[model samples]
Target: MTRSIDTLLVANRGEIACRVMRTAKSLGLTTVAVHSAVDANARHAREADIKINLGGAKPAESYLLADKIIAAAKAAGAQAIHPGYGFLSENASFAQAIADAGLIFLGPPASAIIAMGSKSAAKALMETAGVPLVPGYHGDNQDYETFREAAQRIGYPVLLKATAGGGGKGMKVVEKEADLKQALESAQREAQSSFGDPKMLVEKYVLKPRHVEIQIFADEHGNCIYLNERDCSIQRRHQKVVEEAPAPGLTLELRQAMGESAVRAAQAIGYVGAGTVEFLLDARGEFFFMEMNTRLQVEHPVTELITGQDLVAWQIRIARGEKLPLTQDQVPLNGHAIEVRLYAEDPDNDFLPATGTLDLYREASAGEGRRIDSGIEQGDSISPFYDPMISKLIAWGSNREEARQRLLAMLADTQIAGVRTNLAFLSRILAHPAFAKAELDTGFIERHTEQLFVKPSTQSAHFWKLAAAAWALSEPKTTRQDDPNSPWANNCGLRIAQPRRFLLHLACGEEQQKITLREADLAGVCLTNDRLILEQHGQRTSHSAIRQGNTLYLELDGQIHSISAVDSIALAEAAAHPQGGLTAPMNGSIVRVLVSPEQQVAEGDVLVVLEAMKMEHSIRAPHAGTVQAIFCSEGEMVSDGMVLVEITGDAA
Candidate 1:
């Protein structure tokens, strides 16, 4: 029986809410959006047919307040509620409350949520169900010494994870005994903040295990099926950056084993609707159950693309007491799909979350096998109160190679201006040789951090091309009406002669790219032996500039390039320090300083520890150097790229 739900209330914000609204609308359901004061004008809120204000700016005052959400649902006259992925999605109590209020919760049952909500309890249940699990301590004792001893017994390099939470928050990798206490404290704090539970569990860290998860959907009639697996091994700071369905290197035999395990896990909990069973696969092909998310995952779209299924629709069907429409053997997965998370973050600066209004956010066309799920608009403000992800770019292709190429092209065409982002960094990683071969693991980012965030080479001639374009755009010009013989009169009525030369400074690290441009034409703009062609079409502009912010204003390729003049001296100074020493990565307090003035250290040695975003990051020595000075002390707050230590070493 396909019961129609007239109105559904979305109890979350950002991308996931917008994503849910699309599915709800397709099902002929009128959507209601609940938002906090900060999000009253958000994209999701504005798009919904009905909107309700929760009357507060903070999470607790609005989204996290169960009563407030319930009232908003009732006020909007919604018959069902979609929690999206975060906030209260996994809150079993909230789920139960929604059911009690006679409103359908578009997720698994309350019992299923509670069963898999606690990491320790879920591991125990999985073990009982004969699912392979990592060997570690998931006991009830909360003694620090006991955990420390247990970690040592499990061996060094263990992972401390929040037993009551999901996401990357409240997680830490302890490589040695010296860092155990700090890691534990940090994890506990983060766990408390994220899940209101500070208890954590320790597990042996799998050095090179692939992070793969199985997407499963179950109906009320006890029918459950796995939608296939996704490889989420490409991560930084324990958070997934890129995810792909039909894991590149997985074998059919292994996939069967993992898929069966995932099904069994879901069945064990009597789960309904959409959920995911995550696992860690070792190089030896042995797999261990990580955890079960009893709610929709952020990476579900990848599974949908590969399986040709509407997962959200399936969830709605199950909520309405529908039986499974398909069987295990009947389900099919075709082609390879990859999704990359575009965030407002600085990868070179330790992937710190950035906040600002999106001045320009444009995604590639849907054709050519590209799909984009985004929540931000051109003027949307990325607030510091929530996750910094701006959008998820997904691409599908006939095969892995085609998918990879299409994804790269999509990224190239996609542009986000105004705030710093990980666009270039993501592109570099996708194009990396290791990534192309699908040699992936949780440590992939850490192992290739240097190559991944390498400073742009100054010796490249493209640097001069960008400088020339910047100079040309900055030069003052007169219309063609001013002079009939002007070169600008040839095509459009734009004319310029002896345009004033403008200076530009581009800094990569310690190196500086300085140049001046006076004129620009179809052939190319000249700058100290460098020539750059200015392709113009309407307001769009494209140039061979190597650095960001090189092009100013021009009409090229149906896009507008508005160039702003930057201080040449500041650019020179920035360029002078091409390798700008060791700096703090995010907005965090300096927990410790490992070096003092004139202290010599080798590459990769710990220089400073910064605690930010509820995680601890150790800033290491870039190369062999003598520490010239230290700019901060313990407990001092620092922003992204704030120089914490200066090292004198090889210039190159």
Candidate 2:
């Protein structure tokens, strides 16, 4: 029953599509790429053997249209289709459609997809299969009143989740009865938009639980095996930021239990291809089934690194009806691996999604045990129409400590220009004490918000010196053979008795560093009595100077320092209104205005809800204050730090 698929049509876009195409090409398969109008120039499209235009910019008009994908497959003469991780990958109807069209679908059967597609149905099936599950209501009752009553019985602090979606969409954490109604409505709306299903389920919110998941694979022969586990507790707004294989604090007993559960769950549905079984593990070694992602996960790279296996290759072989190549005992995991998601976001501003052209893009070299999976290139524009993920940086080491150290080193050398990113924020988080010790949970980011987003203190002396140097360097030089009117000659009366003076102004974080420059040359520049040398090597320049006009650009230690010149009058005005605060983190639509003018609120109070990247984020009050003015209303679009609201404190 082994059928060979010589050609593959990749039914997706971005990094995952490019990733799968690499594996397909390695296997000597002719790859066909399908793309929307906006994605015609994308990486995957250029790398594929053949390309088909899906004909629209919006996802629904192109990528999400099943008929369009099916037609493109037929036109391209592709014998098989590989839905890479999203779009139609988990859609049972799409899978069935491919089969009906007489094309091979490289995934699980339609029956298995249906069995685990719905959250409610999946929970019921797991319960019957003797799998541990969180206490919640997954019944058919869809009435709001019934859900409210169930919430009351489940006690306060419950999680309302959309049963048909993943990726943290349609999820709400209701702390008390007062917020239940609003939470439910919001969750349903998000669910409908994200998964085309509004039906949701209520579950007891597990406090401080670590999010872990097991990767499992199965073939048509009814044999399934688990590829160990991954710890994904470090997150922001329920989305995983960092993930590692062979979970940091897992014991052998717990690992075995979770692995066994994952295998049984996959076997229960007769799953084929690759899938992930997520679990929520409490502090006391108790774990509950979260949900099954019936497609290749975003964090699969780390699993592959430690397992020394190519998961994409396995998926292809399994789809070809190949029997399991290794027994359960033959499968082994070695060393440790960690993966960090590099996203186009401003971590300082509530981790808001950002979009812009990639002016400078360079990934860390994959030397030794490093791996980088990137979708963008220099000059590529990061569009707002899709996810804002830039790339995934993965590193493998002999142990978790070594992996952590290597990843930190890799992040430090990583650089991206032209748009705000979370590079600095990620570095801060990785250096945190709690994270170092593996003391992580979903709320880890929220708890350390201040430390993570702290602005660097300005260095006045360094700024002054650098500015003076730049001003001196910009001064006109005189040539002995030049006339006074010559362009190379100094026009003003040159006095050999006194040194020339230039005022320098440098601004750093709301303060100005002013200095006077006298002379500057290849030897050094003088700021009053202090002198510093200048060095130029290759692309890097180093020098020190005084502050000048509102901008100063200097080079130091092989790095360029650009500081804007500050206006003294403007600085005074800004300092006078130091308490006029609280701004939006990024450009997004204001979905909900939680507070009104003249309302008294305490620090950390919910102020507004901003929606970006198909996710909702709550903007809170930074300090206790009386709302002085409201600048935005629900449904209004806003830019970063637009001052959505102004708060006045008693001290101010």
Candidate 3:
């Protein structure tokens, strides 16, 4: 039996919600967007035909409330609810609820999701179905002795994974016996917070393995197919950051073998719509099933680019009881495609998530085989309620090298300011020799740390010189004829007068500098549309500049630098205080305060642990000092740069 869907409600936020709405609209189906309180004016809401207010900003008060989402869909007259990846996408109860309400769930059946709900249970099912399982203990016991015994049996370097974990939460790699207890406790606490499950699985860790996944789809009828594979080996903290289709060095025979196994895994569960079966390819090319994601994946765009098929559209059609459109052989994989996730996080500061207004955001030119899938625009804030992934940059070409080349240019051409991002980090990874050579593994990013996390030289004299000139020339009367005091307004745009020098103050991160600029140093000083253009030594340069309050952002030379403008008065006031404060690196909840008031601590000693976007970051003592005050407490929500603890240097 088949039914037509006239409207779809996307039960998610940010990029995925926006991504789903695009396809739904093109199909002539009305799209409904459900947003939290914070996303009242979000891009997804603007793109959707109908918007529903879910009232609260946090997931608990908004997106995670399945009842509220169903009510919104019903009120908007949506025939289906599409859980885009995160919130309730893989939730078995949510799927059942949708079915109970007689609304279409644009994903696998509830029974299938339950089949693969727990990692340990999923492994048991895979083994029974003749699928290759990674050697590990999959049991119901969670005692300390049980984990210890299993780790010893599996040998050293085992992985403790939360049975209900995804997106790398509650997963840790322990290299030796000494670290087992601490790792276990940390994984348990994280798993409890993330998935509400304390159960875990101990797996024989695969060293130097490649993380690969097969995209599978099924229809209401008895038909299914695999859309080849994607290599997601490049990661940080077990979360995938870059993904590509048609893994670089995989042979066709192996691809087919793995694809069929993935099909079997899907068919065994009676799965429908889009799903992913993940596996780990070891050094010897042998593969073992890891787990199955019974929902749409975050990296589904790369698979779509290579196959030239719209996976989201397919999911919609499948929910309408349409049969699989293509057989396994008819599924075409035209070329190679690569996708990099752009996050609002600082790579240098342990990749802590950032929260702030986008101040200035400009994408590279697309439609030339470069695709940008984003959920943000200029001036939108990256709120603390959800994931910090702002956009995805994807490119396709006839081969791997061509795709890689396009990515390098696309990333370099893109610009983002205000909040700190991992753009420079991504560029460094793409330019690395190993990444270019396609010698990839799950540990590749950590293995070549020095080559990938390049530190920038922010104190260059030439950069300061340019900043000073740009700042002074940015004055309105500098180029207008109405003001007679303009230095270049009357001298035929030439610096024929005495060189007038003025100090231009700027600050970025922890360092601040004031550079003196004279009119004689600038060749071309023009401010047009908030951009500064000039020539130096026959080379032209361009920068997109925006001044918001005391902060100034300059996007030039393939990078965005954020600086705070300072004046003599403000500088003097800051110097008078002569005190340094420790601030929260991102929007997060304070897990615990490790030090008491007036507690003496040494440099590098851990003071507080903050959790944001599903990762823990330690706030350490910057120098040996006494803890003068504590501003935050356990379980308190804090915004970015909110001072958490104050420290005063010990009297020398």
**lDDT per prediction?**
0.79, 0.79, 0.85
Q: After superposition, how far is residue 211 of candidate 2 from its true place, in Å?
A: 1.4
Query: lDDT value for candidate 1?
Result: 0.79
Candidate with better TM-score, 2 vs 3 = 3
Instruction: List candidate 2 segments past 4 Å from native.
Output: 455-610, 617-652
In model 2, what is the error at residue 470, expressed in angstroms? 8.7
Cα error, residue 117 of model 1, in Å, equals 1.5
Q: Which candidate leads the pack in lDDT?
A: 3
Q: What residue runs in model 3 are displaced by over 4 Å at the alpha carbon?
A: 456-458, 478-503, 524-552, 555-557, 578-581, 595-605, 622-629, 646-652
A best-first ranking of the candidates according to their lDDT comes to 3, 2, 1
Name the regions of candidate 1 deviating beyond 4 angstroms.
Answer: 1-4, 456-461, 474-515, 520-522, 525-563, 567-652
Clashes of 1: 22
Q: Residue by residue across 268-326, what tens digits does model 2's lDDT show?
A: 88888888999999899999998988889999999999889989899889888897776
TM-score of 2: 0.81
- Is 1 or 3 the stronger prediction by lDDT? 3
Show the lowest summed lDDT stretch of 10 residues, model 2.
522-531
